[model samples]
Target: MRRFFYTIDSDNADAPLLPKLSELSQGSDIELPDSIIHHWCRVLRANVGDQGILFDGFGGEYQVQLQTISKKKAIATLLLHLDDDRTAPIISKIGLVMSRGERMDYAIQKATELGVTAIQLLSSHHGEVNLKPAQVEKKLAHWQQVAIAACEQCGLNRPPLILAPLSIRDWLAPTESPNNKTAVSPIVSTLSKDKYYQVLESAADLRLQMSVPAAGQPAKPEILETVLKQESPYIELLIGPEGGLSDDECQKAESVGFAPWQIGTRVLRTETVPVVALTTLLALYSYNK
Candidate 1:
């Protein structure tokens, strides 16, 4: 299927440009935004009568056929709405401490492909990169774009939400009581002595003690299996920066019910950790289903 991604603009309420194609009908004339026209006509070299798919990133997608092509805008006739749900059964959110340059971009892209529900960018004591307030806004917008592009490529109907950057301490702070909230299995990738730890269904809300062990501990795949058996569908994952989380940071996370778990025998880069971790969890969840 030929699909294109667009973001909704708040200014134009009636025809909110490329992304929000709300008023679609079988024989209706839909005007494509300049950006969409450029990409579809100029970049993709799409001609009249070519079939195309459009998604607003809200949910599902639309099938259309190009009727007219021009430099100003292209027009397409809506065929039908697709109610396809491409979301994963499990709701996983990754708290990633920001890494430098393309590493952060790559991590966000891969994590979106793995079907994470949301990505919470974090700052930590041991984090190498620090961004100003202005820079944070720019980075957030950039990363959101990256996620949308990834979803378009991966056939994900809904792109994961990209939250603004916040400190790890603040992000992990207790908001409500566990009894009041749904049970969330918190997992942290850390250097721990117990490399072969298994997560039991009974220990769904267990708080694990933090321990520093040598690097190169292999990840236990059964942990994911145990998590999938739990009543709650949510999983909160914490991955540190290049230098990894400080001892204090680990303790703080442990205090908040995050269990320290190792992913591989050798240490993986900050960007590689989320991709590996999310892939393992999603694969196991899919297999069990």
Candidate 2:
């Protein structure tokens, strides 16, 4: 049974129809475009009367029956809108400072697959993907498509938001964008300069940093032990760029109440750390969920 997430606005409660929300249904007529028609006819090899599931992201899943198999488009009659209830647990958030080339793509894809509630792009001193506003739009579209494909492949019903990009200095400052729309406040930011807290699933919030271990500082702590012993709802995760975060930024994050955690001794590629950290956090988050 292949599941496809879609949006449709038909009043019929008997059968979940194909999403003609974009093309037809001005007053009850349903239609589809050639692109989608070709997808069903040629790619899926679907014939008239084939049945499949459709979801409109709003917790409603529908079953539709293929009705019209036109040469240019395929149309479906909606039958029923069943409730779909598989959304990821709301862990904190993950913000990755952008890096060059395919690594950024890889990071976004894996982060979505790992069930992150939201992903924030970071503009840092060592950042990549620096472009004009127009170019930014193109990149954003590309990243969003990556996220969508990830959701399709991973079977996560609720799509996580890829928010408008952010600057490290601005993000580290007192105010930030609201990742949660329905919340009373837009974001978790405040006017006062306070510790930037990002709640992730892991108890031990880790930041991939520039400093390596010296000879004798204690590795784990009592606080981490206590939290790890039970479970934590939110965590903070920071992954630096190719060159890693500067000393000043790390000090700033530390001053703002972030704990320093190291996964291992070897340096992980910028993109790899988030996948590792996020997947680790997902394990912990799922346990609590």
Candidate 3:
């Protein structure tokens, strides 16, 4: 069976009335979203009685069977609920500096597959891309959709939230709270309200900055060893752009309690940092067990 993300849009009158997937009951027939209709009905040529999976990013997924199909509309009947979130063992939020073109998409896509809880888009002094006011909405939506699509492909039931872009200075400001309403993603703000997604709003248990490999730096941050000892630890990772963070930006991040984490002797591209960093943590986690 094919899996599809059932995104919520409370602001739209035609959107589903229920915000969370858990609210939907078995044996109920529900209208499919436009995105799903296009992919499953028209493009895939799915017919009535075809079965598939639907997830709303609240928690679990549902087994559904197509009941109706039309050019612009489709309906599926919920058969059963599968309570498998398939989330990563650790909760993480990566403060990723924007890159250009496919690099940005690759970062978000791979991060979602690795079970990142949230991503905070940052524009640093050495960053490649910075969105203007007009570009923010479109770009943010595009990135969020990228994460959603990754979830559909990777069997991650709960999609990671892609936050709105903020400057490195503003994001690291002592007075700035991570939960500030201004930084909320437009796609998630008005849609589902899950407690799991709210975890990123709070301060993380550990904060690590992916620093360029420098001589005399510890191979692994001591704090990482300490944090992973706890159950389901929450970590915040800072990854810079292609050229890496400026001296001042790095110093500011250090002042804000971000410990330097140099993975290996080799230098990594901006897009590759997330994948390597996440897998390293997972490896460490398994070794500790």
Sliding window of 10 residues with minimal summed lDDT for model 2: 183-192
| Residue 46 lDDT in candidate 3 | 92
In the range 1-289, model 3's lDDT, one tens digit per residue, is 8999887764475754654667777898888888899889888899899999998877789999999887778888999999886999999999999999899999999999999988989999888898999998889889998998898899998888888888888888837765544455555664436688667768899999999999887888887877887778899999999999999999999999999999889999999999999999988887777
The lDDT per prediction is: 0.68, 0.57, 0.86
Give the TM-scores of the predictions, in the order they appear.
Answer: 0.78, 0.70, 0.94
User: Which pairs of residues have clashing backbones in candidate 3?
Assistant: none
2 versus 3: better TM-score goes to: 3
User: What are the root-mean-square deviations of the candidates from the true structure over C-alphas?
Assistant: 8.9, 8.3, 2.0
Q: Residues 48-89, candidate 1: write the lDDT tens digits.
A: 999888877556788889999877878898888888878766
* Candidate 3 worst ten-residue window by lDDT: 183-192
Q: Assess candidate 1 and give its lDDT.
A: 0.68
Q: Residue 205 in model 3: shift from native, Å?
A: 1.0
Best-fitting candidate, scored by lDDT: 3
Full candidate order by lDDT, most accurate first = 3, 1, 2
Model 1, stretches more than 4 Å misplaced?
10-23, 174-224, 230-232
- Each model's total of backbone clashes: 1, 13, 0
